[model samples]
Target: MSDVNLATIDLNLLNVVATVLAERSATKAAVKLYVTQSAVSNAMKRAREVFGDPLVVRESYGLTPTTRGAELLPALRAWLEEARRLVAKAPVFDPRTSTRTFTVACSDAVAIALLQPVLRLLKKWAPSTRLRLLTLDRLIAGDGLARGEVDLLIGIPPVMPPGLEAELVYRDPLECIVRRDHPQVRSKLTLSLYASLPHVDLALFGDIDDTIDRALARHGKAREVAVALPHFSSIPLAVLETDCVATISSRIARAFAARMPLKVLEPPLALEPIEIRQVWHRRSETDAAVGFLRSLVREAAG
Candidate 1:
């Protein structure tokens, strides 16, 4: 290690370093800091000399941190963040009047099933709060949460990526759904009957397929997929139109059955219950606005 004393380090250089690391681009960091690109470049050169590392290198669209750069990021970020919190002016969040937009990642089913209650609450309590709903597909939900692209994610918990925190929001068992007047549903659906019936499969994030398929295989059966859709909302419609049964979350099934002609039945096999969770990045964990949004989701989900 170089014997460079801490007192010799310029604290402003640390700010530039942190901004570059956060944005991964000198141009972007300059825009964020309201400085010219050349000024950011000059600061970066100084940071490289002081740190004795070529911290960032050019990549396709921008810069990526080298190993040494990556190692310094967390500590530098924490220090700068604390300093800002201590010295910078704080902004107040007046939910009743502030026009703040909160972005959320969730499937169409979740949006349809849960957002109404939250919206009604927002209308009454925080009239100026706006919501932007983004689709949660594949593993993008976890990535979005980690990158702070979305404020929160609501869905089943698989494996989450790094820098994200998840909390169980609700739990519901999977249920078999069919048209209200379907012939097979007239009697209690046994294992054999369920396996024999045509199925409408809804594969959200392309994950549930393996688990459901493995369970069916253990019973010496497999579903004859009459329709394959990417969302849960279409499952009920397919089941009602064709002689097909669907395995879906109980909350969705129940909500659909209340208005549409559908019946929810107990699944033949003992499968694991579905656990839906709300996920967000650790950076937003202590933010007051995010806390209020999380509370709204929890209350609405209830």
Candidate 2:
């Protein structure tokens, strides 16, 4: 009926009025609110001024809602209940019962080295949890992690993008892999022999294959790469079928050697170890579900 200054209103007055209407008596409402009856009467007077309604009336029985109070009670009760739920504490993660889908982006090497143990742990602990994997692409990886399209990123990037946090999972040194019955290679690789053999070059990260070429160029030698593959998983099979030697990571090389007729040999020249790390946006730092998945990845790496 008139303009009111909402800033001057006390929300506790509404709670008092609602309680009084429910209890049907100031004395009883005051007891329920842990306040004196005078406080309840004062609250009802302020509520009448705010709402412009005689919210309740004394009756022969006890107290009865006026026509306006009847219309307001249901709405007030619903609003208060919703407000309570809005501020309620979040529920803890229960892996066995939760059917959450976690997304991860990584290279084929990481998938080969870590996915098995991660799957085993998931099966035992969180059977219903599903895993979605994406092939690593650096162009959109940082943005994907920031926007939450990708849950976790596991890779060997030289540096993480801004606003992302990373932790080292493990380091795997470079090694030479060839078929077990290779013609020229035997127990170990010498610089001259390694340079002469046809190579299967792996280019997972952009220009990453250049590291080997650069290292070789320093010694006034170069590798003759017969074929270049984009993924480490492809190198083992290619090497197994031909006389090609692939300079590959130790973990994937050893893994392939166990299953296929491949040999993992130490390289003659020094190569830097691949530092694999897991990265995430700081926004998910406190998310229990994402934390659970991150823990599983660390366990798998170990």
For TM-score, the strongest prediction is 2
TM-score of 2: 0.80
Per-residue accuracy of model 2 over 1-302 as CA lDDT, tens digit each: 57878789998887888898889999999999999999999899999998889899999888899999888888889878988899988688899988989889888899999999999999988999999888877426456887888889898766677889988899999988999999988898889998888889876654446888888888989888887788888888889889999987899989999999888899889899989999988988888988999898889999
Best by lDDT: 2
What are the models' TM-scores?
0.69, 0.80
Q: Taking the candidates one at a time, how many backbone clashes does each contain?
A: 0, 0
Model 1 misplacement above 4 A:
1-86, 138-142, 206-208
The lDDT values for all models are 0.85, 0.87
The parts of candidate 2 lying over 4 Å away from their true place are: 1-29, 37-78, 138-142, 205-208
Query: Model 2 lDDT vs. the true structure?
Result: 0.87
